[model samples]
Target: MRFTFMCKKDMVPIAGPHGRGKIAIVGAGPAGLAASGYLVCQGYEVDVYDKLPLPGGLMSFAIPSFRISINSIIEGVEDLRDNFSVKFILNTKVFKRDTVRRDEGDEFTKNTVDLRELLNNYDAILIATGTWKSRKMNIPGEDSKGVYTALEYLFLLKSYELGYLNHEPPKANKVIVVGGGLSAIDAAEVMIHRGADEVYLVYRRTINEAPAGSFEINRLRRLGVKWMELAAPKRIIADATGNVKEVELIKMKLGEPDESGRPRPIPIEGSEFTIEADMVIEAVGEIATSPFPDQEYLGIKQDRRGRIIVNDELRTGNEKVFAAGDVVSGPSKVGRAIFLGLNAARNIHLYLTTKRISKGGT
Candidate 1:
């Protein structure tokens, strides 16, 4: 649980005026931070930009601090800053045009820097901007006042906990979390922590197929959380004031495997149920958010799912641009993001040293 960046004690620092070409990292999350560590050790002038005021990304803002030590993340970041001379541009969003979608960490963004600006200035640009947009259920009354995405709810609470917000997030007595992912588990735990009397976790699939796995679900069950599998929320029932009062759910049965190779949950007709809920937290999933909109900006192509297209070297269509982490691989665990980041950094180092763009970068 002791999370810290790799030490660069023996490695010579190559920063300052005579260092290698500057590298601009678009995110300060695990991937971006990992790449910054490697690039800095290699003597590249590294600058990281993020929308959040802090430098730890989801580790510092969205994910629970207990799960990831905030002090450890901050310490590693401070080491990069003080020893490696890595520059962090906080509270700034790097995007192209006004088409960038508003995500969880945008609250503290006081300034915006064009993506083209970085492309023009830095020798290489690494886009590690992790997924920030939460996927919606698109059900009726989802826009209700008491309904919130897991990312938004967690971010709001974390901002308050970190003193970025003066007030606390609204509390609920009975909360219902939808989905079977880690986000959903975290949301259910947060509700318990927030003193919710009743916490229900309803998922379309069983715990065996949950993204968070069965152990976590069972652990939450031991903590008094009611786990209801084979159920999907049909809609959020709102009161006259537009506040969430209940959730209508439909029973489901697993059928043939879907595109994800997971058994698709087939809704059973006429098998509906309702759960009283003062608040609803949707943790279905998250969408990868690129700095640019849904277009091939600067020759950087994104899939229909909004994930950036990269070659074997993590190089995008633009020779000078590379991508890694959730932005390129979709939503993933911190370890996976870190691995991709280090890989991208190594490839970038090779490209910079050889002065030859890798073949098939597009």
Candidate 2:
């Protein structure tokens, strides 16, 4: 999404507390960044916290620069951090009432900030934490050394590019990427650019039914990445070193539409096949991660998918707390997330102003 900055002439005054009222926004993705823009423009003290050293969330880290330039994202972030007064607390993840200890293999998390403390310190809170947890395939041998979720694979690749790592890109000559979404495409492209001998994209559906649309699939096809359809991975075959050697897959046929309005793939019995590969990347999708995982501290409501529940004003069950972007709407495009962030900022402004007016304030 193209992020636009508000001109200084169009600025609005903060509603209360001599414009020193504070707002804490969690996550530094498109939604959080956009909200920061609005709140800062409105003269509110805004602080954005992110787990990554850099901002832009998935866009800056996981996604391939070929699809979206890192320069644009960096420029927008700089506009907020430099030109505006949006204070970015980087490499810090806010947890629930009590800190949730960092898990193994979690490279993003460094510092921990308690959610309860944020609640007490800030006038309002915005949880814009986009999905960081990747949905696993849950099949056998998924823990193989050469097997990785698209998020992990892409993050590692980007880490090297960002100079965070001294090592080269993870080595795998034959890379097999699973799923039909943009994540899979990005993984395949990165593997191809990394000089992999062969990179194949396997999906259970045709390009017409892919989540990323037909254009991306066709582009990958044109780039000489092998595209195979109507197949789903069943298991990973690992060697003695626990490195991927091949991936076993089963043919599938489209069945009735599932809850997501997409044709579900029903496996064809006895149609299993295998593809020899040195590495495997699964790009199914991401999972919702709320700062308050226990959900007890804030008493905020959420759907079955773990997405935070919110009203038209983007306010959560706890009136002072609100949620925006993927944490509220689940997985979506950057454009959609940015719009949601802008909406949240506007509603938050109104909410704060109304409270002041009711108390005979400006």
Candidate 3:
């Protein structure tokens, strides 16, 4: 679907807030944007920071533009800028807690403020940093030139489609995608669309155990994307030039159900084979990056999975701090992240303006 682009001046902004209480939101993705939206409604000053030049986080680069229009993302940001007095700081990395703290206090006390400063300066702080660290295959020759994480490949494809990058898509006529999740399907489909002669999806389980939704699976079938079910990649074979040429896979069978009530794959003997492919894309998953390391020192709390622990009200253990989106819920759908962000904004407003917790004891 083609998206119509509107000039910056043409977009409408929310008129409720003119920037009152200071709010620092890390990560300018859907979650951060949503939270900023709600916070502005409550008359809070919001500043959105991101490491990337453009916002939208994973939604802007990790997914295809055909699936989620870049114009729509830009429009969302533009709308926020028009209505709310939210300022965007791009290409800024909040690497240390000190940088956040310093920025919050003096706004210019140091070159970069630390996290402690952020906790102290703003009336409230929200961490919405999305997971960007990709899981490695840990297989031999995975460092080969033609091996790429799903995010890298998708980002390149999106950049090329957006005319930001110059290069032919990797010349892999035959491609094998590792993993059975939604990312696997996305990579496989994109490869086929980009003229890969053949695309194979290698998963370590049957379709039932695959993490992809049924509709996505059906779409793959419709696109003639081949599936090598019950197969796990053991290693990547590389040529002398350090470019991947083939993938070694192990066939497996379902074992007894594990704690998650899902059967695990058990490797089968004498079922090893090699699939020739010019490139391999690993779509395993992503790990979250901890924005607040001294949580205990700062009296902040997080869940076992490293997600910021929040009550029903979306406030973190630190009364002055709030978190939402993937940072608080781990990896999840954009819709859910936005929902949580909006809720957090509302709660923040209640606390700042009304001096009352917005129910559920946030």
Show how many residue pairs clash in every candidate, following the order shown: 1, 0, 20
Model 3 clashing-pair count: 20
**lDDT of each residue in 213-288, candidate 1, tens digit only:** 9899999999999999999999899999999989999999999999999999999999999999989999989999
Cα lDDT of model 2 by residue, 1-362, tens digit? 33436436665434333364789999899999999888887778889999888889888888888877888988888777666667889988887635553321247677788877898998888889988888889999999988888988788778778877787557789999999888898999988888899999999987779998888888988988999999999999999988899999999999999988889989999999899999999899887778866544565777767788887778887777778998888878888989899898887788777752221100
lDDT of 1 at 346: 88
Model 3 misses residue 291 by how many Å?
1.8
Tens digit of lDDT per residue, candidate 3, span 222-323? 888887788999889999899888888999999999776879889999889999989999998766554655444365666555666778878776777777
Global CA lDDT computed for model 2: 0.81
Identify the candidate with maximal lDDT: 1
For each candidate, give its TM-score against the true structure: 0.96, 0.91, 0.86
Best by TM-score: 1
Ordered from best to worst lDDT, the candidate numbers read 1, 2, 3
Candidate 3 or 1, higher TM-score: 1
The TM-score between candidate 1 and the true structure equals 0.96
Give me the displacement of residue 85 in model 3, in angstroms: 2.3
